[model samples]
Target chain A: MQSIDHHFLDDYACRNALRGIDTRIKLILGLGAILIAISADTPYAPLFIAIILSIVTVFCAEIPARLYLTLLLIPASFALMSVIVILFLTGGGVPILTIPLPWLTFTATDVAALNAFLILSRAIGGTCGLLFIALTTPMIELFSILRSLRLPDEFIDLAMLLYRSIFVIIGEAVAIYNAQVMRNGYSSFRKGIIAISMLSSSLFIRAWDRGEELMTAMDLRCYDGKFEILEPKASLTIYHILPVFLFLSLAGILAFLPLPFPPL
Target chain B: MHIMEGFLPSPWWQIWVVLSAPFVIMGFYALRRMVRENREALPLLAVAGAFVFVLSSLKLPSVTGSCSHPTGTGLGSVLFGPFIASVLALIVLVYQALFLAHGGISTLGANIFSMGIAGPVVAYAIFIAGKKVGINEIVTIFFAAACANIVTYVVTSFQLALAFPAEVGGFMASFMTFGAIFAITQIPLAIIEGLVIALVFKYIVQLKPEILIRIGVITQERAERLREGWA
Candidate 1:
């Protein structure tokens, strides 16, 4: 239950100074950074991109540095784990290190090491780009942008309902979990499993019932097939455009650098 | 079973996004049709998506004395079928990526394919097979959920291997290594997920058989038979 609140990042984004920036601009630039990081062959490009993204997210976006680092580390751990596999299982062109295990001899080659480094940098760099957007932009802004793109009404409505229901269902879940704990429902591992199962089923039923009630309420309010909401217009000024342009050019230059790195 | 953000190289990630697009479009069409036909299904589907989000995000104590999260897609697939489950899973993945930083936008296509498409397809297949075989309902639910969870990881391993194959032994070798590493954590977690889903299914069977019947999970006659058997 405690971890549930930790997952809500949009609230943080809304409080940041960058909240006023155009969501569309952030979307384009953020996605551009991700693409550049992924397309870059050398580790230098991604590493540089990651550094720039981190700096912008922390300083310009005003997201706490500690929180930003923690976010980066989440993907970094996964990248490291897979990178380790790539380093050890891959072998060729003069072994850099060799270790004899009980079952198999593990060897790390120069080529594999470079490959692992490339993957690690790219993954981390891509993650940073995503984090920058996520920490600066709210979900409502993204949905509005999606609406402007003329996505189908039903899809947008469903997304809106689903987004609202997340918090409601999580609240219900916490209440149910608390009641279960009071009854010592999770005293043992087996009991914990059973308790969780019961909690989930209960949540399903409650959600279903709430959905029914919601439908009835909407019908009473003369609900049609579409759920309508006003979209906020984001002002695109030079101030907003300049930073994105500068960031992209820097990223592009880093990506096109003539570094002696293995090709992907 | 998610491929962390930007884990895949450019071509591989883009390819997955392209591959997943058709399924998403099909799912959207199905959802629109269902909503148009039965207006009541709109809210139900929304709640189902939210349930998936919350259920998967819950941190539960595992048998290993550590904590793990459930995929929750299998149960959704059982109730709503694969297409709608794909939509729900995609939404959940997007939310996790943006909000929790648990996954990445660049990897959304890969995550959706693995968790949404592959997992639900496997779960639905198993559910249909179980119904055909007249297997015990609880056992069927267990297998469906567990198998779906494992298949997601299996597909993810294949994806990673394809992207970063070993220098010497190639794709199969890399696949085996990634698969084995994931299995250490994923296999047991999948089993636990199965048990949890089965228990939830049992609870629903007892309390709201009509919901299952409405969703075509079981016919009214089958529900009656299940009730009688339990009684």
Candidate 2:
């Protein structure tokens, strides 16, 4: 099937929605998914959810399944949380096997085999919910929700600046790092220091000037004390309600069901 | 050291996390003011945030394939202060949760408290102490980051203990033990974090004289002299 990552979706997906359901509707559904995925006792629900996610990614995101899988799935290797813990802890439900000589210890002979499957589904389930929200929502609209929610101005401001800066500052650091590689690479720890020095010096000077600029911009916008979200479109309707209920129902049903496969 | 789903029941983490939502809202309001007040600082904050984000995403080898990323908040804390750091981290955590699923939302309050509040407040206090004590600058930065790392984990452990009480001992004992598990990974991470902080600070001191003034590491008078001396 298709890869689950939303990051590699086609430009068409980013530019236009397949269904283009109301943001609130998608948001509600996605949030409901998060709760359901978290509560599910059995792993099958998550796997099913993952499969659904793949279908959505393929049709809605307009990305080729293979490329998406290669780019996103490969990097997803970072999801393993406790392969060692399960190996030594009876894999929770798996049978135990012990080793002796070096030190008397315990392990599940099938722990590796089981955990790989378990963790993958868990990560995929949780990940799909998040991707749905992120890919569908634009940054400004996302902030708009926080504003409508009556969030504090201070936190919003921090996000505003931090978000604006992520791309800028990263660009500078990359340039510095590129220069460093040209000279010595990170061949030695000492060389790494030189690269850091270059990065840090620019980091400070840039932040100071930008801080003053940001304050002025806030004053001009009549920012007041509270962070006011410019009123939303007020166009929400049945579109929002349906997806939310559908996703919630799907996840809720999964939470109560037992896994057909073994726990592993 | 991020806590994931199923580690603790949903009810506990959810209630605490939801309770803190207002605090986050208030924090947002405050940061908006800072932004309005310090528009010039936008580009700089971006660079700082990006520097940290990129630097943080780099994995450090410790126990085999398990890699711990730096929060990189030592300097962010030292310069921005904990309140602002709280705002910054809230954004970062939210993005990470929604995008990467590296941490949990039910633990957002807990995350902010540990990484944002604990690290910055502790790091700032120590840094100020070192400066007042007239300790070496590089050492001060390194020491502050090192202390921050330890304190952050200790606080995070307490957060975990609150959620998951072990059967072996009472809640408090279990809390301490839970904190200890992270302390194991954090110790080496702290040392490396310290080294990185020291190196970055040292490099800044050498390459960009203007930053010293902006960050308050040097007074206006000192900055003038440095410029005059160079001239």
Candidate 3:
């Protein structure tokens, strides 16, 4: 709701390169990697991918690695929580690694170790890869890619509307939430609950009204189902294709390569 | 619970990614139309998404502070239809994961499909059903929120179960078990969510009567109540 954050969401960096790359290709490459990373047996692969992606994001996409790393805590904490449980629940196989923690025991089998390692790495790696792609790419272009890929007409149309309306509702939510923060001092535990509960109630109304206002406006516009105007897609360029291909190929080769034991 | 990275089997998330292909296309097409029709509304959607995002930052009364983020699908579905809300939920889950590392990018498809799509749709469907049953607005909202919460947890549990294997009931058992553990928090949270939805609806209905008429989002009971207030 702050003016600065609102401005940040609307930003589309790497505009020139972004425009040049076919939206469809990026979707395929980006989404495909997501699939690959999620399915892999070990997190090492995604970690490998993440390393490569961090490089690409910095060098090719020109996004700051620090900015990206800062966002990582959210996923890292989640992975840690799950992995810790898995390490405990999944123990009793061959003990690959053993660690003693304060009031917590961590003894695991090879499978669990592999599972823990893979899940952690893949989740973290796959996520970073996505962030790299999403930040570098624009939402509209991503939408166009959806169109080119033959998404359902109804589905795409709905996204456009929701995407448009979210900000309006957020303004209201922020206003209401901020008001709660002011009243309740959103820091403490007890007050936070009341604030959150109130925010929930308030956000629903605002989002609804916002949606209705949008619908009315559209109704006035001689609303047909068609989205008449669109950002034109750039023609295919070998320059673009070559990079995506190289990236995928490199990831694949890394997957196949045999790394030495204690893969440092 | 937002399943973190390196947790669920990649095969499951991969299958979900495959399923998302069609939705991604549809989502983009929707984006274009939405841009043409409803550009002004996006900041609100972003804000709502951010609001939920910020809620995670707040750390409410859950035993696991970080694990229990609020589900906006019911609110989103009630306000913006599920189709749009589903995408918003998907975006929230993805960005939360990517930006905050809250959830995994791989599981995002499944996460969105379940919590995002299933929860909102279930809530909307139940709300509509409650209307037919002549339920009051407050109760209707509560019922819908409860159902959405339960459905979201149930679906996520099943998805998680598929990642593991059980001898007999398999995912069905996992679904119920996870539901049991989390239901305590979810129960009150769902109620809170419902009350929130109801109040917001009440406020907005007061502000813009035209919107309810156009989107047909409001209930007859609530509309009648608003009319009584005016009288």
Candidate 4:
């Protein structure tokens, strides 16, 4: 089973030449693309954005095509489910199809279909923007950005510790899960629940102990109440900033371009 | 249960982000106070946040005989308070978005509102009310956990409904549709979460009653009485 806490893309990000690019530039550009994608009134605009973003992410960022495809599909089930609901609930505008059911009548209209398409495109576009950043930037760099933003010390410290402890706790949970499997502790559903409950309870206790030990260690090191870590200085050049400006300008241009299809 | 990326249109997502801001700010204040009062709480809260993230990842057998993940917010809310639970939940949500691709950053504010603010607030309320009514400790824990899980989905449904209301019946119809769709899975998951949380609460009471006392979830006298009974 793939570990939920692990990010395969982060390793790629570390190796990618884009790792040295300023995180702030990436953050702004990514967010700008997402905002444009979301606010785009027409499906064509978002569709264009999604394609361009995908090309940049997979090619420029050196993210594996297979990994990019997998990440894009992560939201498929959710987006499909909501789109289905929207299709069913929305009505009026040249009925495409209708189905009579025992409980309720269902109708699909052109407007509804258009709405679903818009949602799908926008969602994909927004996801592409997010993937571009997540696939290219490491969490430490993101955290450093947060630090540079001058967020609350407590918030940053807690986030740092939480990030570190995730690996530790996941390791502990996996160990217990393997031990349980070896013992056939999950042979039945009831047994599985029992085993999982025990696993969680034990994990909680162990995490608490770990936290205490961490506190003691930090204190031994003359730890102040606040945590302090050095932030990496990112070098930004015109070469790095050019792509962002170009992308933003391209998005703006696409937004104004007339759509071929009739407005929904 | 998260609204997907770009799921909510412009104004709705922004509205949720603005609404959720106060709770997150309050959570910051609560965290600062806790750390100031007890330096040890800093690490404890971090570990607690990690516990939430890990626990949410674990797929447990639901009452419907299907596997589902528990939210884990309720357990944290009971152990800590709602505010700190909200902060912990935001961290967990951010991690999930970054690594698991389970949720998105664009909808982070909405996710925080539902999973972090609404769910934990409801859980905290239920816990307080259940204690005031002198309910069994385990039963109260069960209600707190179960209600929190259910409320998170409920709020999510509302968020979705508000964003994409039905053309004919409007928000109510869409809300009902979303609610019914999620209820099929979430109800059973919530019950299982409740039971698991209750069992964990029992284990903590038996093994580390002092934690409950220290967190002010239970009074020192109450902890002593419970320990004496177990003894």
Assess each prediction's global lDDT (C-alpha) against the native. Answer: 0.86, 0.60, 0.61, 0.84
Q: What's the CA error at residue A90 for candidate 4, in Å?
A: 1.2
Q: Give the TM-score (0 to 1) of chain B in model 3.
A: 0.80
Task: Select the stronger candidate by DockQ from 1 and 2.
Answer: 1
**Alpha-carbon interface RMSD for all candidates, in angstroms:** 1.6, 5.6, 5.9, 1.8
TM-score of each: 0.96, 0.76, 0.74, 0.95
Deviation from native of the Cα of residue B84 in model 1, angstroms: 1.4
lDDT of 2 by residue, A19-38 (tens): 35556666776666656665
Docking class of 4: medium
DockQ of 4: 0.66
Model 1 chain A lowest lDDT segment of ten = A1-10
Q: Give the distance in Å from residue A68's predicted Cα in candidate 2 to where it truly belongs.
A: 5.1
Best by TM-score: 1
Docking class of 2: acceptable
**Share of native interface contacts recovered by each model:** 0.82, 0.30, 0.26, 0.66
What would the DockQ be for model 3? 0.26
Please give the lDDT score at residue A93 for candidate 4.
Answer: 92
**Tens digit per residue, CA lDDT, model 3, A17-134:** 3445666676667766665666554455677677776776667766655765666664565456445545544544577767789985456677666666766777766776676666
Docking class of 3: acceptable
lDDT by residue (A57-120, candidate 4, tens digit) is 8788778899889888877877877899999998779989899999989899998998888888
lDDT of 4 at A256: 60
lDDT tens string, model 2, B125-191?
Answer: 9988887887766788899888887887787667656654543354675566555555667788888
Best-matching candidate per DockQ: 1
lDDT by residue for model 4 over B75-99, one digit each (tens)?
9998888999989988898887777
